[model samples]
Target: MITRETAGELLARIPVSVPDQPEGESPTAVKASPFTGAERRVMGILTVPKWQQGMDQGVLPRAYQDILDVVRDAPGPVRAKQIAPRIGLPAETSKIEGVRSKLKRLVERGWLDEGTPGLFTPSHAWTANSAKSP
Candidate 1:
């Protein structure tokens, strides 16, 4: 068994190589924006519950608002099974099926965009409105 002193010696014998940077290019740091493309405006996220008032004016049922919120935040198309738990439904087959039905209704009503079969995303209008400053 090697003692601590021998372990130190063994480690000291190892050579470490620094990654080479481009010959003349200095390292540049990228600045991070407060919001990524997928992020809704701070006001919009805060007012999602308030947005529901607008939805109510449009005749959409209140139950659909949560599903729409999940779709709006997704980076890409999402399946109902994936959206189930976000709205607090258990991830069971029945729950997923119920979500699927709601998704179809939303799609039909133009709140969501249809991507690949069984996949749904936020509508362009929804994103545009939510991203507006105000």
Candidate 2:
């Protein structure tokens, strides 16, 4: 997982500057996405970014790992909801929303694959341990 400090370091190298305000009267005020094509390419490589800060404080139980293990060996794409229960979270309002949150990050890191919406599957990059059981 990338740390906040790491994200800041990579972002600093880009030519663009971060602004203090989201919207301002000045024409030169920075926009959310001030980067050009080149910057986007660099940003893509940064997987965790500052969002990792949240995970550091979040609670992740062994069940979560089991869920990933289950999906890893699925014959085909799996749904996010299906994996949720395997981790002991069967609904969105479960106590451990962190499970859901980390799943999103995993998807972003290319450790898992996503489809139309709620569907997901393990990415090829996952090791055999992450695969499903027979």
Candidate 3:
């Protein structure tokens, strides 16, 4: 219920104390690169999709390529489900289904050639011979 003149006098009575900071240490000084170890860990978590996409080339999943190298090197067609475990996926019902979904997409994208229904081989066009072809 204080009047404006009284309020101003009361506010003027309060004093603000700010400690004197040393002038030598700059608040905006250039520190070390923020990309050092701990920050890299944070960025690594953020960039996983980009990293995975680079590994996948947008067609195969990261999980597939881990096993694809083995499958593609095999003499004959390799079944999609068979590659799941070697790529670290569980062979159990639900997880296998997820792996199968990605494998089917890889097959459809021409990144893999489905030799027999579920059996796959890498497309020769994606191989070393790609340079030789038109």
Candidate 4:
């Protein structure tokens, strides 16, 4: 009978770590992805560059912009519960998941970054480009 609250607490106690290292690095040294060679090049390609069009105006329509606005203003990575109130949803419990779903879509499209597992932040690309706008 593990309620969500208890499960979350237990999960929090567990330490997070990557399984293995890249090449010659010591196990305890925290490889943490040096992003050497082609790895860096490929990752750069995958990331949406700030210069890409439409991002300044915000890529998607109203709701997506609403959610992005919340993330943009967050001082740090924020939990979904913290985001619900500002999402412009219909003030129903079910709206939380809807908000989460929109966030996921934004992540996929390179508009957001999942900075830590469930936590989110505006993608570097988005913030960088946003600064260039008037």
Candidate 5:
């Protein structure tokens, strides 16, 4: 009888068909199989790392890094509404709220500081630590 591991291996080896490509695309182009072993492992890994002194900002996912960069460059503490447009997001209420949520996450992770309600700035620990590096 096939065990669960054997069944999973069989399923992962199956090639999935690609949908029609856009115009100018070669029909003979090879498509990668969906849910390959390596891809599955990567997808399961956590994207964020908790802030620690000497830990580079590169550890963050791109979206989180962009938010941190914008806050760090600002003249002073900034609001999510002001940050959204700078980060390529529309300055609408929904988008601002989404940015606000990410900002809050950064605060919780110790990457940023909230000196006043709805205002954010880079954490002193992060700035001081990063500045000490080359």
Candidate 6:
């Protein structure tokens, strides 16, 4: 076992190299925006906008659009388990729960309606608005 004093001496022998920057470049230079020149807005999965008249479904991500499509094509409100298979997900309990959480989020965002427990359907406002559009 080496003493603390000997350890310090050993560490002091290690050479540390610091990179030298050219005269013009500053360390904190502003970087270009990652979204530069992009036309569409970027949003996280949970940041789905509330349903409104004339809102385009293109604003949503593909996974969300798929969910909405499945629900819209259904005869009535659908359960998460029923949704999982149609969306290409295996009908496992965990997958069902994941779909349920997304459905709940859609309801909270006004994109869907939860008229009764465990059943999800498109919100009335969304369906009505979509029907009026060409």
Highest lDDT scorer: 5
Q: For candidate 6, write residues 1-134 as lDDT tens digits.
A: 36766767876797654356456766555354443332243222345666656785766768788899999999998999999999999999999898888888789878899999998998999989889989
TM-score of each: 0.53, 0.40, 0.47, 0.56, 0.67, 0.65
Query: Cα deviation in Å at residue 80, candidate 5?
Result: 0.3
Residue 5 of model 3, lDDT score: 70
The lDDT of each candidate is 0.67, 0.53, 0.57, 0.68, 0.81, 0.78
Ten residues in sequence with the least summed lDDT for candidate 5: 35-44
3 or 5, greater by TM-score: 5
Instruction: Report the poorest 10 consecutive residues by lDDT, candidate 1.
Output: 45-54
The digit string of per-residue lDDT tens for model 2 on 70-115 reads: 6765777666556666666656755335555666776775556666
lDDT digits (tens) for residues 1-134 of candidate 1: 45767877876787754355555554453333333232233323322222321233133445577888788778888999999999999999999999999888777655777877898988766666666635
Residue 116 alpha-carbon offset, candidate 6, angstroms: 0.6
Output the better candidate (2/5) by TM-score.
5
Pairs clashing within candidate 4: none
Clashes of each: 0, 4, 0, 0, 0, 0
What tens digits encode model 3's per-residue C-alpha lDDT throughout 31-127? 5533323222221232212221113333334565665576667888877567777777778878777766766666654556777787777765555
Q: Write the per-residue lDDT of candidate 4 for residues 74-124, one digit (tens) a residue.
A: 999876667888765565657887788777777887788997877989988
Task: State which candidate has the highest TM-score.
Answer: 5
Error of 4 at 84 (Å): 1.4
| Residue runs of model 4 more than 4 Å from their true location after superposition | 1-54, 90-93
Q: Tell me how candidate 3 scores on lDDT.
A: 0.57
Candidate 3, residue 113: how far the Cα is off, in Å? 0.5
Error of 5 at 116 (Å): 0.8
Q: How accurate is candidate 6 locally (lDDT)?
A: 0.78
Off by over 4 Å in 2: 1-64, 90-92, 95-98, 127-134
